[model samples]
Target: MRMMLKAVVLWGALAVAAGFASIGAVHAADKAGSKIEVQKSKSPTTQKAKARPVSKASSSQRVAQKGKVASRVSKAKSTRVAKASPSAARVGGSKSSRPTQKGKNVAPAMAGGVDLWQGQEHLAVRSGSALVIAQDGGEALYEKNARIVVPIASITKVMTAMVVLDSMPNLQAPITITDEDVDYLKGSRSRLQVGSVITREMALLLALMSSENRAANALGRHYPGGLPAFIVAMNRKAASLGMSRTHFADPTGLTSNNVSTAHDLARMVAAAYRYPLIREFSTTPGATAEVKGRELEYRNTNQLVKSPTWEIGLSKTGYIQEAGKCLVMQARVADRPVVIVLLDSSGKQTRIGDANRIKRWMESASASGKATPA
Candidate 1:
């Protein structure tokens, strides 16, 4: 009986110790579960930083971080796109569906393309207006304000010669210079004095070759119906030549009302080139006329006609304060017929320099296959 009671007490102590150890283990597991819950309750941004790539976030993360954080991320992305657009357009389109910024200006660049010969170096000229065109081809090789009309100065003489020849007037008839033939308006002097008598043909020759204002006036005065009638005829002839922009206020071009564009002057030069007498008389280097039994020599007004380098077919030069130095010509350049008109040239030698530069450019174009075929 004593042995049984001792064994029973020892068993009771062992059972109580086992129960306490189980309770302690249950409390440890509950505390561990509570720590996991605390970690899961963190803010979305912190969770996202820990869980996602720094460069990009998942849509779910963005939605999870709604309000201020999401708005900030969206705004930053839009700003980045806006800053990249211009550079992307310069390099090439960033997106294939989006139109490039540079695409709008492409057509104008092609339309006003650089000349075939003027690849890098543009031809520098001083004339206020100029035009260089192939005679038969109608190809404009060069142009500068060619359509703007201004006073044509004595380039009017070419038209005067054309009209005089058009009338088929009696070439050998005597014409007397009078006070009416004098340039009273401008006070411009003339070598042809009053009462000087010359044949109509000589007057025409002097008018064209020497740019003799009195000679031109005498020719106009001797017309079938006089100076006013002659002015009417001048306008009629200009209209006939398709020189729509040209207007002749007087036969001498002394009046600034005598306005014409380089484009119209080119047409006039082309028409003048057709008349054989005008061509011969205008290009004659020098001639002598007998006035009051005294012989006076009158040289051609154009200096280029005397130059060996020029193969000028028809040429004229004119100047006044209102109209700066002006020149027009029909010449064969690089074996091709071309018409050149230079107007309002300020420098004394700028017209000649421009002509030389044009010739050199044409020759260069021909050599390099840049010239348009005739």
Candidate 2:
């Protein structure tokens, strides 16, 4: 009881102090209105820890606890604010907005302000890795140990898609989702089921978009020359892409030896980008279909797809005990196309947060670009 009271008192003091925090001038003019006050934070803002006002179950508290909708007015205001235009973003705060041609209304945010990863260990920590985003041509953002070779888990599927697309392009080709396709792919979420009848194209969608191991395996099994031929082709495709550091032992990224550096993976993503189908599939979100009389639901593995600030063109997510959490993406930020690769992130959410951090860093750098005030 005393601790709670003290917490409440501290919260009040902080709130009062914030009102006089002397944040100087930060304002925003938006399409909706110009009343937004984006005060320049003197210190990194701490998120209000959401501790409900000491229980007692008020109507509002109940609603929030149950995850029920907040008041309609608040929700509408939030939605409108999130959809704020670039012009409005310029009204105040260091909010940086970039254009994106693909996803609707989402502005690509650059690695915050340029040297996002600078001074912050230029390489992955131990099992971790980072990239030096390139500005010219189609090469990696610079890398170290990126190609030292590690188990890639689902990162392997990008290569599988490349090989399968090379060998199998007929969308109308009928294929059955057999038990072999669904075998050994335990613990991973998938919509592919045994005995489901789907087109070859559908299998590819699941393999790449949904990371359905069963779908990937089924595609491999359905290869005209079977698994051996499929493996041979996958290797051949890697060599053809000039990915000397990569080797594929399976169609799915589940195997331990499915190794590739962030650099090689970047090359893989660039190659994948050439295929319009791959791009379409990689960026697809929340698609549905029926297989074998059962409803199949597919959702994008990347949550940033729903972000209002990202113009993600193509993306993939991978994870396994051996590979940790991995993500690779191509998105335009500050109108510059950048490919981001974060491998072996410690937590499931860290990779995504890292992307956001990088975006913020880039924006900060761009805002002050090579200029010293007189």
Candidate 3:
């Protein structure tokens, strides 16, 4: 019986030990599950850290896009500024339009009704002084330094012709070119020899058409009171026409003292246009004068008078050391009668280029219906 009881105690001990082991295994399992849950919770933080580079890349892209947008906006503002500036308009909106060197004083003025074309397309004129006016209404289409007095060079021949025609001298009368007719100041060359004899009408034609300095001087010397009296008459005529800024020192225009403004010259051109002979003679393309039994060929000084594209009623060109490449004309451009005067052009072709530019600008304005009537 004692042996059976000991065996029972051993069996009881085994059961308790097995129960304790089961409790310990359950606690270990609970702790393992808690650790797994904690690991899962930390997984989101790890994912957020991995995603930082993507967020930074997105920020950089936004910054680059903003920079591009700002650059475009800045360019747009600059373009608007250029379009609004007058000096910029003169240069066709070029960055080099900023006034520099001799072009600094060439800013377009709004005087003399030029404001009529304000905000319209500006002309790119290379001449230092220029003027354009309508014949019908005497309205100024364009003006730059028009009132400023400057040397007119050989353009004085127009006034000389007018004075000679006013005297009603015999056109067929013989006028001999003498040594006194020679250009002393300018030493200019002429086809009319020292002893060459030509009719009064022929001399006038050569003087106006060919710009013969000797022929012009001869006409002055043969006047009623001599060359001095002829100069007085020129000044008197200028006063009558209200050319307040005009003065004539010589009839041949060889003297740089023969000065007149573009405004005064415009008036002189208009007056000359009224005379049928002045218009015919000045616009003659080419003529031959029988001088001393030799046929001497003479051509018009102004080339625009011969151009078929230009309906020039009158034209004259002048040049000297003081007066740089001057040209004046009354022509029909864009179907409007206009008087154009360009003076002090630096280049031989600059005056012609400025004329063509003015024509195109007027035509464009007319086509766009932006041009106003005079």
Candidate 4:
């Protein structure tokens, strides 16, 4: 009986111990699963530290993100290069650059002026009033404030020359520069003193080539009906030529009242180009004449006449306080005859710069087949 009881107690203890061992194993497995869950929760923060959403993205999405970043970097580099370019600097840095005229088929502005274009190329013209016309076809090439009247300064000498030549006066006739010919109104200096004697032809040459105020005044005084009649003839000639906006108060162009528009000046320039004497005298680079037994040297006021590159047929320059600097020219540009008129330039070199710009623009246009000769 004792043996039987001992056997049963031992079996019961063994069964209880087996049950406790199984429970311990299950508890260890549960602790491991909890640790795995905690590590999984920390993985998202580590992923964010590496790359915000890319680290979790698929391979294809990552490639697309890299491409977007490269594109942005390339665009930034291109922007820097464009800002540093010389052409861009010129367009942005020049003080005289201005926007194109509204509703005009013009190009963007360049240094020192507005860019004007009728076709592919643009010209930078600095004058306040400017015009360019084809001499043969009368086609307008470029225009800026061309119709507004402004003081013409010494350009009046061109009209004075025309009037004198029309009368067919004796070229060899001796004309005396009297006190009346002295510029009392403007007090302008003159190489021709009172009591000096020069032929009518010499006076006209001086007036045209050198813009001599005294010579121009003497031409008017020696006209057929004196100064009053000369004035009348000037107005009549202007009226006859359809120069409705042109007016002349003096032969010397010293008077501020003497004014004309760029349009009218183009007509005057085209008309003046017809006279062989006007073309010769106006384009003469320099000349020397004898007055009162003294030798006086004179040079052309328009410097382009002396430039070897310019095929100038006729040229004139004028300046006064009220009129500003002015230039008129009949020249062959880009193998075509054209008339250019510039007025009211702010600086001495502005008109010349504008002329060169126009020449370059025309040549460029002709090369590109954008300009056709008339």
Best by lDDT: 4
Worst ten-residue run, lDDT, model 2?
A: 98-107
Per-residue lDDT over 1-374 for candidate 2, one digit per residue giving the tens place of the 0 to 100 score: 99999999999999877765634222222422443223323222322223344444576678776564556767777545543443333344443432111222222222423322222221223337655354334333334345456667887888888888887568779788776665464456556656678888887887778788888887888887998899999888888878888888888877777888777777777778888888888888867767877777888888987788998878888988888888888877656667777788778688888788766645544555621111
Candidate 4, residues 1-374, lDDT tens digits: the string is 99999999998889889888888888888888889888899788777777755555777677888998889999888655544342432456553442335322222322113232333223557798888877753436777788889999998999999999999999999999999888777788987888899999999999999999988999999999999899889988988888999999888899988899988988888898999999999999999998778888999998899999899998888999899999999999988788899899999799999999889888886776655544
Model 1: worst 10 consecutive residues (lDDT sum) = 103-112
- What TM-score would you give candidate 4 relative to the actual structure? 0.70
Off by over 4 Å in 1: 1-120
Model 2 RMSD vs true structure: 31.1
lDDT of candidate 4 at residue 198, scale 0 to 100: 96
Q: Which stretches of candidate 4 lie over 4 Å from their true place?
A: 1-121
Query: After best superposition, candidate 4 residue 81: deviation in angstroms?
Result: 23
Q: Give all TM-scores, in the order shown.
A: 0.69, 0.63, 0.71, 0.70
Looking at candidate 3, what is the lDDT of residue 192?
87
Score residue 356 of candidate 2 by CA lDDT: 82
Return the top candidate by TM-score.
Answer: 3
**Candidate 2 vs candidate 3: which has greater lDDT?**
3
User: In model 1, how large is the Cα lDDT of residue 117?
Assistant: 27
